[model samples]
Target: MQRDFCDPLGYMGTRGGDVTATMAIVPRIQQVRDCAAAAGLTIIHTREGHRPDLSDLPENKRLKTARAGAEIGSRGPLGRLLLEPRPGEIVIDKPGTGAFYGTDLHHVLATSGIQNLVLVGVTTGVCVTSTAREASDRGLNVLVISDCCAEPDPLEHEMAIRLLQIEGGYIATIASTVDFVASVNTLAQS
Candidate 1:
């Protein structure tokens, strides 16, 4: 679970080019995070950051340029972790759009025996959607808690939802944060 979730302002301080901020999603992510924690689910966090040495990647000069703009290595706005990673929670530093991109996220999930990915995060049009698509492609069940992800603009958020649900080839739903928590609980029981 990400404290930033989908609110780029809180994480990035600036929406960059995005016009509006979805502040509403934060609380839902908090609720889902709490519920998942109580259920003993292994919480994994993926943040948009790159190591200063760029040891995390060895290709794509364009990626280098992009990371430079995002200040992936520096303790910029996005680098400040609002929710500190707790013991047993894996914190993966993702250098690319997809959480699994340029990271050991797949290996981590496989080792942890996570068959389903309850994905909640920011930039609905970008990182969150990309992660869901990749997860689905890899045969991992992915549930994108719709209300739990936000974009800097509402229209983009809505567009992302449509694409993910209609053509992303994943089982997606527009679940509120509370409903997602309930589902996790129910899943744990079953």
Candidate 2:
């Protein structure tokens, strides 16, 4: 977790690398996906990248990026980070940092009767924080597993946690991968 991938040197204004847009939670994302499968919890993914045609992104966001062409459907290194969801898993292509912004994700969660959103992904200060706040605003219970997210700035990451614990909708629950896995396994046995 202490590698350059987990370090701040990677995420923010830096550019041009295989990991520029790769999911920081790739390993844990896979673990969460599998655990959700065993626990009968629906696994959903929110993608932040836009299409290659730039049809999906607004002009303002594109203008601010180091490379204007780094959306999901493009041929850039960032575009290659998205993993295809499983057959039944849902993927919401979001135009913004927050998953619920300008998307029917809340509707889908309600339709599935998902009262709890156990969130996991990249950029703790940006995407993860935004998603958690939005989920709280929408009346969903948000449990953010600390080990499953990464941020460019360590201070930002800590600030994100503090903000979530203090003002985020519900009290944000933190857990390690080992603890989470063990809890899931216990549930399975019960």
Query: Of the candidates shown, which would achieve the greatest lDDT relative to the real structure?
Result: 1
What residue pairs are clashing in model 1? 5-121, 5-122, 6-122, 20-152
For all the candidates, what are their Cα RMSDs to the real structure? 3.6, 4.5
Candidate 1 regions with alpha-carbon error over 4 angstroms? 1-20, 55-79, 167-174, 187-190
Local lDDT at 54 for model 2: 62
Assess the local accuracy of residue 123 in candidate 2 as a C-alpha lDDT between 0 and 100: 76
The positional error of residue 30 in candidate 2, measured at the CA in angstroms, is 2.0
At residue 153, what lDDT does model 1 achieve? 72
In model 2, the clashing pairs are none
- Index of the highest-TM-score prediction: 1
Error of 1 at 4 (Å): 8.6
**Model 2 C-alpha lDDT per residue in residues 1-190, reported as the tens digit of each score:** 2122332343333443334322456687678768888788888888665655768778777666536343334343222234567888888878898999878899999888998888877777778889988888887888887767766555667787778888433656767677788888998998
